[model samples]
Target chain A: MKKIFKNQIALALAGILAGTSAVAGTLVINGDTSDPAPKAAFQAVIDGFEAENPDVDVVYNLFDHEGYKAAIRNFLSADAPDIAFWYAGNRMAPFVEAGLFAPIDDVWADQGLYSLMASSAPGMTMDGKKWGIPYTYYNWGVYYRQDIFEDLGISVPTNWDEFIAAGETLKANGITPITIGTKYLWTAGGVFDYLNLRTNGYDFHMALTSGDIAWTDDRVRATMANYQQLIDGGFFLENHAALSWQEALAPMANGEAAMYVMGNFAVAPLKELGLDDSSLGLFQFPAITPGVPMAEEAPTDTIHLTAGAKNVADAKRFLAYAARPDVQTAWNKALGQLPTNAGAGVTDDKFLNQAFSMLNNDAPGGVAQFYDRDTKAEMASIGMEAFQEFMVKPERLEKILERLEKARQKLY
Target chain B: MYSYWKNNQLKIAPWIFLAPGIFMFSLYVIFPIFQSINLSFYQWDGLGAKTYIGAENYIELLDDEYFIVSLKNNVIWLVLYLLAVPAGLFAALFLNQTVRGIRIYKSIFFFPFVISQVVVGLVFSWFYDPSNGLLNIILEFFGFDTIAILAEEDYVTYGIIAAGLWPQTAYCMILYLTGLNSVDPEQIEAGRIDNARGWRMLWYVILPQLKPATFIAVVVTIIGALRSFDLIDIMTGGGPWGSSRVLAYYMYEKAFSEYGFRMGYGAAIAVVLLLIMMVYIATILYRLYQDEKGS
Candidate 1:
């Protein structure tokens, strides 16, 4: 009777061990899936990862883009996932500084991701320690209706004067020159980043974000002046301040608006609205002044591991797989973005191909985006508000600049 | 011995019954308010250690142009939102008749309150759309140029307040409807005998009896106006360059939104907002206290 009881206890112990091992092999990811194609693409990668590691199970929790930011904060503060998608730059600095994120340096070195990622992944590092890996990036630029440009006999402009001329030409042809929604404020940032990059160049933008340059600096004033010019030229959608980015797309897709100065992500929405690849085209933002170093659109996104994560090994393995060339190609292709992986094959989609080529050949001296990710959040809030104020009442420029300077002083 | 034991048990029973509620109220409400006040005197990001910086945040607030704008806007919201009280009363009176399908009509009038603020914001945003929106379409039909209500700084705040009023008016209507149900029928008959009717009858008899509902309505509307975050967050995000920002939204932007975590500064903003709210809350509580004493 004693032998039989001992044997029964041993069998129960084996069952419990098996269950623990099975659970340990699974990885959970929290990400933003605001767009359908990107969500579907991410799911495909998850399936591929599971297929490659048959012992591993991948669980994904997806939220809307804007909703994900709030959800991520809660998740990080409480029960964090093993792996998560987050923005890089100063945005990640707080989390990294708090040791809420695991350093990815070991995995980064082992995979030699730097070789494939070019210089893009280095931006994910803080205090000389890498914390995240980038899968894809998109450039911010002018997306125009090619058909309208053709109808108006306007060529894509490479200079500021020509760009304004193009806007006038489109206007003459009964097309509103641009469609942008500033209700969220960051949409305005995309346009402003390009304007600043083209006018003041990259070093000044970096200096501006870093507090070395005041908001009222001549370089900053020039950037706002260029924006004022665009506004006065009747560029941008009617009632843009009332519209969201999706709402702004309607006019562009319907050919009522001729241009949209936005990121490559805008292609997905344009396609979703039933506009074909041929309907849209991309261009570098015109050089604001002759001989200024012209930068193309911003490139940023990161896949990070939480410091509090339990499944650190599994998370690293998942990130390594994500950085693989085929995974990068498949992911970017599905999302209509440029794969940071060097060997990732370019898509046949003309707009995407153009974006990839631009990212490869002519990307500006530096690779970071502006506002939210680049500057401290405290500064961004004030700076974005200042930008919005400048857009509405150009007369308030001096006050807005002074106020931003005050916010900068306090924040820094 | 038996009388002493029974008296002690009765005294302790009331305390026991009150303990759980009082504990919860202090834990969730009272404690957080004190914590926020303490935090207001420090400088800390959401993460990292906090450092004491007495009165610097407050002094900065004095010079904060955006804060000044937000304060002015909040005052406007408070003043404008009070219009819901009388408007709701009138709506309740119109729908209180014992006509056929009156129940359906009442429910229809409360529909705006049933929907979430996000949906309300979306609906109102579409209504104010310059090109394809219903408002502009109607204006164009009458040969008027489309007006972008949300884009112009002069009109943006009014546009947001109009959206806020839709649900606020509905809330007021429901409160008045309940008040009307409990009105003394004998008193109404007495007023009718004296040939009192319309505005005169309402002012003299019915309105005075509905004071409790009006008081509750005012309290709630003031709180709602002060806490108006969702509509502005969704519709305009206090844009056309911060023209529509209220204190709550501005506080959130300063503390949480993409800006750096100025948790200490945010707490400072919260403290100021709380002080402003305390004035209204104290007045309401004082009146309630007087009524209890008189009774």
Candidate 2:
């Protein structure tokens, strides 16, 4: 009888110890880095983190990239992970407003991230407080075929008139001046954002996207008129509405299309398609209104700590680690994107070098997140559809703008 | 208790047999219908607290242009999808003859119905692809301008409906093929003796006996047309600016898509679809009752 009692006591003690360890030492992270490169890159970060903090046991859950969007809503309020992957700006606003994300202002102050990660600070901040740590961002600009440009003897255009002239020259040579696919619709959103940013400037563009300005305003029409110029010129590839963004790349690769308005992520795929550095070139989307300060589009990806996190201390530690310059440098190197940390060095690739310098030195106004990321989700969906419609049928711009105005009033 | 059961065994036996099915039907179907109707009166984002808005969602649906477009597309789908029934019947008649290796032809005809709807959607998407699809190639060969079928707002609905008919026709064909097996040969012989020719014989003799098959085919086709979502989702995602949307696809977009979680609005759409479906459902029930009473 005494030995049985002793055994029960021993089991109880072990259970108590295990429960305490699980509460204090285990950190859970959920992310959607399911692609091979990003999967491996994140796994390496987890390895390094575990090695540095041997006392903590890290558990990571990887979700399918497309499915993760729906899954985040369920897990955030029901069973939150310590760290969750997300995007910056208005994309994260719904979650932040619902108080599902925990604020980490102390972590930012302790790590001096306000200075170290100054470039992306505005994107990560909501209501005067930082809600997440932005690790990587990529620039959006015009990617062109250098050989085609040389063959036509057209120098890089720097203003609206020169841009139109160059496109006309390319079209006269039996080549499409630009190729874009709006089947998925966001490609057109990128074009609309850049046009609005250049035509009315960044502040006005922000106001319009934020639902503060009526889409029927003349400023929005000015942007649409500039877009109509390209459509009327027939500079875009034919039958683009039927193709995907990836499918559109084939025309550019085959020299049928000369330029693409795209993000830095297009470089790797272009290289794989046999376009070397000498054959492929990157340039900023040229000036439209001439005096609108040059703002670039650079969408930032971030990580957050959830409000329901149990291990807040370790989660904060992970956030701090993710914010470090060296860690971000290595992470962005693997991602083939630019580091959000101002102190971090970029990979020595041609596109990354050019993008890094362009974003830091040349862009003076500010970096805005791409259209879908900057605007409310419902607004983005409606706006992207309008953009796609305008690209296909520019004559219906009035009706489209009125539709957007109605949606904006209803949604906001 | 034994004496009570013995006194009312007939009534008790039927109740015992019906218990599980009744419980399940209420749980899965009947309750959800009521819940969706209730949800239509509220404003909820799926995660937040629901606010009672007193039929405001239905009010919005009246003004929503996308809703109108989806309704129009659904009507087009209903009218076009019924073409599958007659096509299937003719196909069945053509395959009814007993030649050598006739089973092979029947199997080939039934092939589409066996494969998944997703695969059907994909194959048709590739076939309709503008630059590289066989369709454009044929158009170009005929010295005609190639049309992007899915990208054109006017033709996108018809394009998706055509894809849907591929499998739907095969399904109806299989149904009629089975119904053909039980057809009375004696009646065909009598019709032949009476000097009935091909069209006359089929209309007066064969069709009356195939009434059960025709009834089933029409009901299933109507149901399938109302729920035509997968093809629209896979082919165009109701895209090129939501021109190809139907009620079912629009309901999904409103409730589940990344840019939407307007639960109340989605429920409103669901209620509208249910009301339309209820019309046909009521007719079906009435027909079934009349048939049952005649027997």
Candidate 3:
């Protein structure tokens, strides 16, 4: 028995030594890329990074998309990995303020990302310092049924009057002009962002989201008036509060609805449901108020370095690699999204090309992240709830705005 | 050590057996209760340093309309949930007869309780779906304009409670079924000879004997109603404007959800829920103690 114990001790010592050696060059990453396309895209990025740094081993922990929103808060403080996936703009502010994420200005400087990713730099920065590297973003616009438009002899609307008239024509024909699901609440937020961005211009919209302007202000009311016009016209899908975003797609797919004010992510599922590029088309959310510079909604996705990262050196290397134009081009191509790198090449997809040109040339005002990403989390929750309520009960706009103002007073 | 143990074995033996259980209970349950109560007094975002905020969280709860809405919904849940006790009793009485394939009938009635709550929630959500659901389809067939039951703020809570009742009624039915098996037949026969039948028979003879079963059923139902988080989460996510939020779901939303950052406020809500639960439990314990003495 003594001899067997001695042998076991010798084996245990060898195992411990081997573990330490493995830890020396391993880079741990935790991300919420559980979807198939994103999972494959991230895997390719890891493979490319590992190929460049032959001696390093990358350990990636992929979390479920929804669960990761809550899991990130736990792991960032409890068992911080070298790198983690997150969003850009105000969504990352809480973590940055708490010091859970480390500043990576050095990574950006070394990567020459200041000019390469200028469009996304403002989103990735906090307090005059860059916090993370934004890799990909997708545009939000009106995705309509091209066949339906042709049947009605309706052209794409470029202004608020034409947009309302298009909806009126669709409504006259017994079709819901817009199919939006407010069950999750964030979908209503996208509609609100477009309305506010168009009605009050980008600067005022930014100020309102940042709580520099009261929610009950006249500028906000102008945005609400535009939204109320759509709601009163019965433009949205019936019983939308009962459906999820995916469920709302059914009406559009079956021709019960003609248009959907949504993000590019909707294109994939819509195509799978048999609406190909010929049947589906994209248009900007139209200019609401004349001379209100046309900004666009493009929520950016980013990767961050945690403060408790064990392998800072190797993690920095991965951040720099992720920010590269070549790396972003391949990553976004696989993701079916737009790369943040100005020099990166886009995929040869119709919707992607249309969105790329729209954001690059048409948007002279600015690019605003969707409403939830542009505001405080608590405020975003309350604001989105109010928006959903307004969509369902347009008569309750006054009460909704008052409630939002109260929440803003307390939140910010 | 052996001599002392032998000399005081009767005094110390029970403690030795209880040590492990006591340690686990305190670690998992008792300690966390106190920790949560302590946490309610501080402002912590689940990440940065905690700041002592005294009674501010509780004070804010007093003015929060959402808190009041949650408390009101919880009250509604508690009252409506008790209906399951009688519903289960009637079901049990109906199924207790010995007939052709009686066991199959019992199993069919008990099926809801056997399945998971998540499945129950999903099935009911699909059943109440606005556009193509069976409920709307039937309503439309009857020439009644279709109503989105889960989406309307007025009907949302009642709809979820109806779904919760499916499994809860099954659970109570099972409890009463076993109680009915061991029921004293002599007293029931005597009561029948007294010409007591139907409601009178159930009220006097049957119900008196089913007290033990009724007691357990009521306790479990009240506890289940107070801790109703899963159904609310799965079905509506306390949504359609958060009109169906109960205290439990509200507490979770404030502390742990994707947008929640007010850890201290969530703990305060939890403490209020605990106090409400404690009032019921303490009264039940008092009644139990009184019965013990009476018997």
Candidate number of the best DockQ? 3
Model 2's C-alpha root-mean-square deviation from the true structure amounts to: 7.6
Clashing pairs in 1: A100-A307, A140-A297, A377-B258, A377-B259, A377-B260, A378-B259, A378-B260
Q: What is the TM-score of each candidate against the true structure?
A: 0.91, 0.96, 0.96
For candidate 2, give the DockQ: 0.40
lDDT of each: 0.80, 0.88, 0.90
Candidate 2 C-alpha lDDT tens digits along A1-412? 0000012223323322322222688998888787888899889888988999998888887766665676777777767788899999899998898899989999999999989888899888989999999989999999999999998999998788999999999989999999998888888988988888889898998999899999999888899999999999998888778888888889999899999999987788888887999989999988999789989999998999999899999999999999888898899888989888888889999899999999999888789998988898888988998888888888999999999999999999
lDDT ranking, high to low: 3, 2, 1
- Candidate 1 chain A has its poorest 10 consecutive residues by lDDT at A1-10
Computed on C-alphas against the true complex, the DockQ of each candidate is: 0.41, 0.40, 0.51
Candidate 1: list runs displaced more than 4 Å: A1-28, A55-64, A77-80, B1-4
Going through the candidates in the order shown, the clash numbers are 7, 0, 0
Q: Please give the distance, in angstroms, between residue A251's alpha carbon in candidate 3 and its true position after superposition.
A: 0.5
Point out the higher-scoring one by TM-score: 1 or 3: 3
The superposed Cα distance between candidate 1 and the true structure at residue A98, in angstroms, equals: 2.3
Please give, as one word, the docking class of candidate 2. acceptable
For model 1, residues A57-142, the per-residue Cα lDDT tens digits are 88777655654654565566566778878877777887888777888888878878778776677568788888898887777778
Ten contiguous residues with the weakest lDDT in model 1 chain B: B253-262
The Cα RMSD of model 3 versus the native structure comes to: 6.6
